[model samples]
Target: MHPVCEVPAPGESLAEVGGVNVHAGPAIDGRDRRRLERLCRYVARPPVAQERLELTPERQRLVYRFKHAWRDGTHAVVLHPHDLIAHFDYRKSKLGMAGR
Candidate 1:
């Protein structure tokens, strides 16, 4: 499996890393899908959901951890799929950097 990069933190979203606006859909493309599928195959079961934390009044972050197998060996990566806005509490004020 290829080396996995560290997950970006809230407010640090970038296009190069497949980060998207909180309300947007998944940032992965066809190539990323293939890589993720290969990684899934290495593990006996599906990936695990690590955490879901609030980043802002409107955005939440979801983290998934998975193991990938390659000719060399197995490796682990934590995937950050963010830009998820929670609609229930829209009236709350945005928090500062240290709040989240």
Candidate 2:
């Protein structure tokens, strides 16, 4: 699977929890779709940023950061569950999925 791209901040609402741009909808290519799916698994909660600094204790330091969903939220989602299971089941069924 390809690495997921960093989504633009202003475009947050425009993109679904899975990073599927609403405009692109369900028509996304397989690679992006897989990335979206991976993203979706982590969307139950808000994302948090983590910072890391790399250096040799020298003159310059490189900073890196990334977003991730909180473990509490993920645990909650798993514990409480949701209709997503049924939704996926129906989606794979003859009735076809509702809502892109």
**In terms of lDDT, which candidate is strongest?**
2
Query: In model 1, which range of ten residues has the least summed lDDT?
Result: 16-25
Checking candidate 2 for backbone clashes, the offending pairs are none
Instruction: Put down candidate 1 lDDT per residue, 1-100, tens digits, no spaces.
Output: 2213433665443332222123222345667878668655754552333242223334443432233465566343322342223321231222222223
- The lDDT values for all models are 0.38, 0.41
In model 2, which regions exceed 4 Å deviation? 1-80, 95-100
Q: Pick the candidate with the highest TM-score.
A: 2
Give me the overall lDDT of model 1.
0.38
lDDT of 1 at 59: 40
Candidate 2 lDDT tens digits, 1-100: 2225555664343334333334333344567878778667655543322233223245343332223446654312211113434645565453443455
Q: Per-residue lDDT for 58 in model 1?
A: 43
Q: Model 2: C-alpha RMSD to truth? A: 17.2
Worst lDDT 10-window in candidate 2: 73-82
